[model samples]
Target: MLRVSIAQISPDGTKEENADKVEALIRMARGADLIVFPEYSLGARLEHADRLAEPVDGPLIRRLAAAARESGLAVIMGILESAEGGPYNSVVLMANGDAIVAHRKILLFDALGSIESRYVRPGNMPLTLVRLGEFTVGLATCFELRFPEIFRSLAAAGADLFVVPAAWYAGNLKEEQWLVSAASRAMENVAYLVAADSAARAFVGRSLVVNPWGHVELDLGKGERLVAWEISRDAVDEARSALPLIEMANQHMGTWARVRRIY
Candidate 1:
């Protein structure tokens, strides 16, 4: 069984305040194998363009690395990254003080009231896959959830589990979108879906675990909470055996392409 912890808490503008909250939750995890955190929940700087990105050796990632090494834990954390003259939204995966992968968010949310495009650079890499013991883990951020192609790429790369760390904004029926997207992704790819959402006033929290069979194994309500669940590797195989969506997906391949010029 693989144990997972989701930290669903609102974040303040101060780094110390956010880090303290995360540290408290990390300590509560106890024996969890993987712990997931929400996007930009370490500090609220959605409007700030300059002070976003921190180096791998910087305080943001360094702090997470220390926690991982001390607790023998694996973490999937979302942080704003600064690069050259621009900032980027990224998910950094760490294990035992080592960063295994850094997936820069490809889809930037600039439409409507979002100014992400002004500060952040759009990523070009496809969904990145990381090996975790016996299973391959996949990654995707908040806005990336709207695109099914990224998920398909990860599934094609042999990912058995998908981790989504998001600060999903609240809306009239946004919760439904989360439910549908999670279930559909799991069912379509026959993989486990673990989502960590922020419980801030602007962002609704509802961290969840969905099995390959599209079942909700764990659900954290719209409140600040620490939720954990165990999943079996055999369950992944059994789901794929019963419904071979992974194999069937090959028939509908080559449909999505990278956007060359944004309008």
Candidate 2:
């Protein structure tokens, strides 16, 4: 079993404040095997994101790596990655004081009048899957959750757990959408889904963890909090055996071969 902790925090405009929150959460979740933070947890506002950008190996990430090593817990968090064209909203997975995997946001939020594309560059990288303890984990950022194809691809790549770091905006029925989408993904793929969302003022604060059976194991409501839950590969296996969706899909690949070719 892998013990996971989710840190839901409202990061301000300063990197120092965000780093302090991460350190505090790490100390609080002392025995967890992995801890995840929300997207843009390094403090980047849409208007002035350039000022908050940092290289992958910048001081902020280095401090996070050191903290992960010291706490003996793997850390997954999002930050603004300084790049050639523009900053990419990316997430890094840190273990043993080093970054093992990084994923840039493929689906930028350009539909909500937020104009994320104006400040951040879109990424075209492949899905990142890494071994974390007994689980093969897949990483995805905020807007990527709306795309089911990404989750399907990760499942095909043998991911047992999907860790999503999101800074989901709060408006309309967005809260309901977040929960439904998370549960749907977990059930469809028969995999555990762990989503850590920001509790920032304008964003939704309900961070959640869904089991392979589509059961909500942990949900941190609209406030800053740290929640921990136990996840096991056995649960994933059991869910798959019960549903048999993935197994059937694999067995009947020829059915979709023509569709894939056409698409």
Candidate 3:
């Protein structure tokens, strides 16, 4: 079993303030094997993303790495990244005092009164997976959760857990969509899904953790919260053994490939 803590906090336009909050949360998350923070945890608003964007090796990431190393815990959180074309919505996984992997947001949230493409560049990089103490964790950010294909690809690459750091926008049925998508991704991939979302007014704060069987082990409402739970590898094995969905998919992948080529 892997002990994990999720920190759901509202991020403002102040990076230092947000960093302080992250430090406080890490202090509260003592003894956890893995700690997660919501997207925009580095304090980048949509309109001001470009101004706040920083490189992966910037001060914020360095501070987070230091915290992870000091606490002896792996960390996952979202931030705006300065890139060649523009800023990118990105997430980084920190362990052993370094960034082991970083995933840029592929599916930018361009709808619902917000235009991410204007300030955020869409990434074309492949999915990233990292090992965290008996778990191979896949990384995704925000809108990527809406695309099951991304999750399927990660599962095919042997990810046992999916971590999503999101600043999901609030709207009609938005919260419901968040819950359903998280549960669906967990069940279909037969992997644990842990999503930490921002609690800001413009975003939904319903951070959640789902088991391989589609059970919501933990769910936080519209408030700032720090919660911890254990995820069992045995449970994942049991679910796959019982359902065999992934196994069946693997078996027929060749046939599907042939059909796709023929078409």
lDDT of 1 by residue, 35-129 (tens): 89998756656676465456666776677677777777788888776666676788878887876346888888765477677777887566788
Q: What's the TM-score of every candidate structure?
A: 0.90, 0.95, 0.94
Comparing candidate 1 with candidate 2, which one achieves the higher lDDT? 2
Give a tens-digit lDDT track for model 2, residues 39-87: 9988859777887777878777788788889999999998888877788
- Which segments of candidate 2 are over 4 A away from where they belong? 257-263
Candidates ranked by TM-score: 2, 3, 1
Model 3 per-residue lDDT at 149: 91
TM-score of model 1 (CA atoms): 0.90
lDDT to native, each model: 0.79, 0.87, 0.86
For candidate 2, report its TM-score.
Answer: 0.95
What total of clashing residue pairs does each candidate reach?
A: 2, 0, 0
In candidate 3, stretches whose alpha carbon ends up further than 4 angstroms from where it belongs are 257-263
